[model samples]
Target: MNIKLLSGSVALALTIGVGAVPSGASEKPNVVLMLADNVGYGDIGAYGGGAMRGMPTPVLDQLAAEGLQLTQFLVEPGCTPSRAALMTGRYSVRSGLGTIILGGLPNTLQEEEFTLGEMFKSVGYSTAIVGKWHLGFEEQSWPTRQGFDEYRVGVIETSESTLYRPNMERARIDEATILEAVPHIYESDGQGNLTPVREYTLEYRRQIESDIADAAVNYIARQAAAETPFFLYIGWTHTHYPSLTAPEFTGKSTHRYGDAMMELDHRTGQVLQAIEDAGIEDNTIVLWMSDNGASPDAAPWPDKGGSNGPFRGELGDPTEGSIRTVGMIRWPEKIKPGKTNEMVAIHDILPTLASIVGADLPDDRPYDGVDQSAFLLGQQDMSKREHLLTHVNNKVAALRWRHFRIYPKAYRGSFSNPSQEGLLGVQVEKNGGPDIFNIEMDPREEYSISGDNAWVVAQWLRFVAEYNESLREHPNPPGVTLTDPDFGK
Candidate 1:
């Protein structure tokens, strides 16, 4: 095992119990976190969505009704960045992943950082990540080294997908780089070693989601019978560009895009059923969400793709449609079934779970996430998160406080738009008045109140000032990106 220990003073101190768990909760609840790739805000039934023009997502809708639905959950604009934030409970930029991993190059989470998987393992919880482990593709950086006990991962660079070739064409990746991007599956044994399983190609692409879900179901049953709590992360690769639908679900929706989403719903339903069958549904915490908003301009999986519903802009932009996404949690009798208008982000998951498990966060580094256990447990009506900093390529693209958002300047892109070349000379001006919107009232961001609402504008600017001060107190540098030298042929 090649586990790199944390260095310096930060590694010297370890503090637990940052948030008080409710009394009389003895047994640690099992956790199952499901993440969809490139899904839109309105693409699920609970959010008024179906796979086709208005396909019905009965399973998701039922899950929302039985769980708590968060209306304004935010995530990073891209896949790798979002996953990084969710795992580390900090800004992706702090993890050197403010942007997606470039083609032919590998980017990974640092060894020093503590992850959600590690946090669970700290409390003696069995952990497994059954799908995409995009945090890092390198040997030492894989999930096994990061704390997962068992892993079934598909290794792919950010440029590759279920439909790898089409993505290469869209990104204009050279043939050599494209050849280096073959998709392969491997299983890990919670060490630095991995055993190759099979090649993931178009013929078998459609079955990936089902296979992952099946693996999760089996894990759940085994954990339940053994009397040990477990953490299962199902990273479903669906609804992204070149959305692949299983053969059985083909033509099940109005279009190929819808078909893919429908398939996602089906696979999710299977996992939920497994929880029920294992008789751990009430004692388990099930969470559903997406990595980020969907991109309508994704050329590889084009089919009048994705509807951000009323929100404006698309993935890769600072707009609400890019960050705000569908979020739900079902814990049977523990979590009251209802909805919350709270402002939460992917970064909050780690701290929230830490509080629930009565565990402590690492005392050494800066953590951007807050404990939302109180909010989830119904101890409080409001979320602990009050403000969020939205970024694009390490630059603060927008500042969000309460119900308002202030975009520093005009920005545009969705998935592959406004390439790295476009980001080079990009200038976000502060001289001209900023564009502000009361996201609560105008979810679409159609109207700007920056010119009319003086109080709101002043309040937002004040928040930014305070945030800047905090950033200075605990300065953060981006994580390291892998170069050819570090790739280790």
Candidate 2:
């Protein structure tokens, strides 16, 4: 079953064919949701990034060209909000993930809200999530209780945890802990408990320990024959700040990021292969998108060479770079195979998938996300969501309506990274001050001008106050804004 390449084309030929469906056509397609951490837009081949100045991802490009490559996809300005949106299909502030999730804080994604994993599993799809999950860490909100049949990876401390072997470099890329030879550990009982079961040092090592790809393949191999369909949400912690590389991938590209990108591509190919090998490729929907923009675009490391391509803002800044990043979906049986300029928000995935599986969401909860099922099916004219909201923990907020991105005047900077691409950025500064930039027409925010647009900015500020008021009404509201004693005085 060799995939015959043309006379001259790709070096490693791949046979893309799926003939196994477990005799269940009405059982809904198996879904694989792949999420990237802190990856920029132009790093991949499918996005018109030339190899000269960009990384080459043939496998990813092939996936986009053969599926749905969303050009205007947007997410939260940081990892937590972006993840929260992907899981609940709700805005970050509404779900209490407007800021990064760390520092042993009890505040996490509320258990009351339904996650995509939980939603799909309830409707009979065997669900599993592997890789970085910054949404929550406590038992109440762990992946096991959230509907995953199998959870392989730590629920918390992944951003801080790194591995080599026993008595190796206690040097951590994020947060350091004393341990040994821990590569891929599995958490059973719903992330309540964990144990180490496997370790690979060669071909599989790069995909497993560093990429979160092998566990995904294992899940597919084990369930490819099951009578029930499956939903696998595979998240990878690659290209994120404090970037580490597998030994083999260290010098794989011009920059450290290139090696990471190549490693990600191999992982992508593996997941696709798992589906194809199981003969479920034609019957599965693969949703892939980055969480946010990039870190330097948002925080302390602005010199990291992370670019938002043509995006104005970087990450937490409310500019296009901050919110808009990579998004694409592949489904042979559902979505149209091509590219789309149709603007879509990051919060639209939840209800859309729920419809496909015929699942019911909580009746009492109000979700700000609109179901873009029609848009997915090639019927473009489906919605009129006037504006998309951009929220920073306390620094700033805005209403994004089409080309006009208006913001509140006299607003402090955001606690989230300045850019939305998911790069780590400095938090709020004590010299916390007011600054303004026309995000679309002027992105760098170099020229601060709250003077000329004072009137319009004032109106936007009033709207932000009202938005904050609504958040306060929630059971778990966001942190207060205008921290100093200067708000009311």
| Top candidate (TM-score) | 1
- How does candidate 2 score on lDDT? 0.64
- Cα lDDT tens digits, model 1, 329-364, are 998887899988888889889877877786667776
Please list the Cα RMSD from the true structure of every candidate, rounded to 1 decimal place.
Answer: 5.8, 10.1
- Which stretches of candidate 2 lie above 4 Å from their native place? 1-26, 158-186, 189-192, 195-211, 297-303, 382-386, 394-396, 409-475, 478-489
Q: Model 2 over residues 251-297: C-alpha lDDT tens digits?
A: 77777667777778777898998899998888888988898776544
lDDT score at residue 170, model 1, on the 0-100 scale: 86
Worst 10 residues of 2 by lDDT: 9-18
On the 0 to 100 scale, the lDDT of residue 103 in model 2 is 41
- Please list the residue runs of candidate 1 whose C-alpha ends up more than 4 Å from where it truly belongs after superposition: 1-26, 153-178, 190-192, 299-303, 413-431, 454-457, 470-474, 479-489
